[model samples]
Target: MTYAPMAVMQPTAHNRAAETPLPPHAQITYMERTSSELPVTEFFRIERPSFDPATGQARFFYRLNDLSFTETLQLPMGADAAMAVSPAFAKLLGLTGLVLGVSYFKLRAPFAIEAPEIALTDAERAFVIDVYENGLGEFYARNDLARFGKLSLVAPTDPVARQPALDLPDRTLLPIGGGKDSLVSVDLLTHTGVDFTPFAVNPKGPILTSVAAIGTAPLYVTRTLDPDMIRLGKEPGYYNGHVPSTAINSMIAALCALLYGYSQIVLSNERSASEGNVVFDGRETNHQYSKSLGFELLIADTLANATGGALKYFSLLRPYSEARIASLFTQSTKFDAVFSSCNRNFRLTGNDGPLWCGECPKCHFVFLIFAPFMKKERLLAIFGKNLLDEPKNEHSFRELAGLTGQKPWECVGEILEAAACFYTLTRHADWHEDAVVRAVKADLFAQYGEEKLQLAMAECLTDSRDHHIPPALAAKVAAYAV
Candidate 1:
């Protein structure tokens, strides 16, 4: 019932208003913080968010261990932005703030982030618990913390995600990550003549060039994190690891669909996301858990409950494996020069550096997946070097090829896809002698025989039925299947 004050004027915070005047909705009284030791805080409190519909900016506040931080999301708004705001819209905005609280919550790794400031129904509260538990699965495992997980955060709850009925447009909102997977989605949707808009948050670099290559402007959203939080993470005793970034983006995309009048938010998550990296603390920790189908279903159900069924979110690429998507990516060269799957380009702190670092697991996997379907020369040209020829990359490739340790905690693909690609490459005279390939070929072949490898690859290229894609859209997509 009471609101938390904003924290933009703190000495450590950057003055965002100097760049633009504070819209009346963004204007809030500033408060100073304690100048002493970090408090032994027990709760990661989610505060009431402040928003200005005129500009579509929402500032979310959170307090962790007595330290306050503010994060902002600038949604798409203008004359085309929805003017008729309702209680449902505000509720969705509140939920956005709630999910975003995970950013600061992980710092102290609090026992509870109950978020008394945000008005969530009992069902909504349970949804937040699942997000913190499963979404932070990797975080807990990496930090050696056992506080929050399956047995940790589950409260006895009932299922009650009410779908709200509203007259939303027939168009879709495609979230392009400027990768082969998303660009593949963009090409397929265009091939089938589906009306859609490209959307991204904090888009720059390849996200810009890749969409520019497609010759369409994406609905851009800017996300600003508090400088203090970044500064604190560098200081001693701050917990840091991965958070479910896609889950955070999904919330923003839903807001875009509502404000921009789109009915569906299409994602590029693949079937491989469902596979976990390793099982620790009796939990199967997945690197792409947020992108998995289970999380997609959770968001869909939560959006229905949050908006009363006004919006829909699902992955357009869910039915296909990473190899199938990679094969489809090679079908067109429209984004070949610009599209990159390298995680090096998207790091939070450092890499605004290379198009493809050509060494990380992401680069290795992308190169591996595309080799069977793309020309060796063309694939090498795209990456500026053959990742397979680099002997230093062999160990990591072994992990991806399912010949070594558990999948290197990255958003690469299912182990079989990597093995299948390696198996397919062994027969190619042009590629068979590459250093990494030669090193893994013997081990990879013995692990999966030729017949089994071929069958697995055939299945990778073929689409599966486990998806939520509409029958009509599925038919249209099938008509243009590569």
Candidate 2:
């Protein structure tokens, strides 16, 4: 199903104030909740967002009732003169402001989102609606917002002219997560001789160190969140949980592509990211929804249309599963010491955290998935512990292998993909006796027979027909992933 992103949200006379520095707005004061315990937020509004071609600074404003919030980013780039003159920049900025609204909108989560300031086409309206509804699926499920009313987006606008496809530089900008998956892409792209630059919005220890091992200069951007937003999360009556972070990052990448003259925004999201974690109120929510193939296609098409194919977006590792990616990751040793997939280590505002926090689902899953593919000593040394041998981690493995409970609310593979790894471990002499392996063996086999497990393992090792990889890069992906 191709979603047509027609000339969207044509800006009107409102452009002058939007392009200029923001005028003073009301402060998003605390305690908007009424005495009845129900929030009084009836609507969420996207105020005009601004960008300065001189400094590459951008600001986004949003409001919930009388309260207003701001978010800003200082990009390490000068805005493109040509792109600034074109309609692409404004449209991209507007769309970006619309998507970034999720961060603040999730705070109050009112039923209505009104963008009367910017006029949007029907297609733009649909895109924004999806950004709020499906993009916030995990937030809704986690907060158990079933009793809350359905969400609506109102973007009354006249259609504007679409930008013709501009000729962007022939280069790839890869977002490094300081994980095994992105490192695999770095190795594969390097070996295949692709001209790409490692990019990150905010560099953390792991991401910086891992990129340093690649021995190349990486482009880094600085994004600053409103301190009030963080402070409010600690305040009473405020809602906080996961948001569609990848969606926000994707928009940022597109902006960088425009300003920095990069043509391709390469991601390393695997095939298994498409799976959702749970179903609530007849709605399925995926922790990795923004990283999934569906979101990939949507954003890819949106960029292709918005930038007129001047900028392209696709996950280079989309055809492979987490287990397969792990197998490929073991083939590279350059980032073994510095790479970390632990969620705790990738916090937005922290440093010097442990490379691996052994207790989390990310740690357990990464260790377990890699156990079947790597040597015991090497894999264990990287994580600084043998997660499978620990008795307490058995329950984490249990949920990952689908023996009990729902799929974890983390960036993990499908249940069968995890079960395949566990079953392969059960057959391995090195890992068969591990506490987690032994504990899950009976229930794992009972739920998925030996033959089925073997089939799942084989399937994960094979390629998927579903992906948005360009034809030129297809063989490289197959060679590296398989």
Candidate 3:
């Protein structure tokens, strides 16, 4: 692949050679460009060693250079495992460069960082700068900080927080997803008397149906993936793995918020988003780092600064856990039939396939968590099968129960929630005869025992209360026995 050359160099070298080396398997090369131009930066190359089958070890390196900085990431991999990153992820990195350019303009910083010879159009640069400044302004105000420390250069003074008794208009932007989270959010916001406008992108059948069931004013955005980009994947050499969905979704959410003219953009993101990613070296990195409080705050700050305090962005369900959100939906019969947490149906290319690929981690975790609260038959109807009945799902259930492996990095709450439900179900006489439940009891349940399980449940509940579960939901949960 072709790449632009470096623009200029102001080298300030600092060494930390004592730091522990990263694993051999994964490497990431990050290049930031504040240049006012399209295609301002490029990721030139990535290299990974062939794994040794006998010894089970591999190494990888990533390199990138722009006028300002040349950096490399080195990683080692085990024979049985590999580190994967998608080309979509590289696009996000590109977008991040654009965002940084916007940020630099807003901050009016002395240094102009750009890819060598690449320049942005004046209009595009202004738009990015405006958005970043608007976002940062609100962030400082909301946090009650006296001044923008490092962020001051990019953000204007926040006027919104200066007003002591500001009346925020009761306008809501409905976050649409092909999952249960949005369904629950729609229900809660509707019942709470907020005037809402439903917004969706890349429409699909199940999501459209769910939105219709909510009976709200719906707005749809059409999105078409660039055909040339898709064609690139068909070539003999293409990189694909996982792009941080949070980054893409945040951009989409911001765009939607702008078009809809809504003050508050309500997202259905849950507490589990704060859970760290499982690193290749058995260490944990926050997988939802993009979805976590840090990203949310940064985006919100950037919008406030860029817009001059005109917009507000936040996850309304940020304080709620997946389990608590599930419980909230369970209480509302209106959503019982409409909601779905299955990931299979949400994919862009897999509609003709099974709606619930029951073997996936998400399906197994969701089914297990909801089992104790919803009636057996009713829950099965929602998922189209008794997921706990299958031996394959049973294995997944054990994995989630913290039996065979570390918790899956997607969401921390899944493991804790499943553990609580498994604890509750094993003690109940009615659920005792279920094959998966029995298997759970024999294989993993017996090891934890009742006291340990109950303690684990209490810890989960306490942790949820401390971080994830919203106050209103916490009150409701306090009244309900697990």
> Which candidate number has the best lDDT?
2
Which ranking of candidates, highest lDDT first? Answer: 2, 1, 3
In the predicted model 2, the residue pairs found to clash are 119-157
Clashes of 2: 1
What are the TM-scores, per candidate, against the unseen true structure? Answer: 0.87, 0.90, 0.62
lDDT of 2: 0.78
Question: What lDDT tens digits, residue by residue, belong to model 2 across residues 90-184?
Answer: 78888889999888877777877888777676666767787787788777766756422366778767465345788888989999999998899
* Tens digit of per-residue lDDT, candidate 1, span 402-476: 676657778988777688888889988878999988998888778778986787677777786777788898888
What TM-score does model 1 achieve against the real structure? 0.87
* Residue 401, model 2: Cα distance from true site in angstroms: 0.6
Candidate 2's error at 192, in angstroms? Answer: 1.6
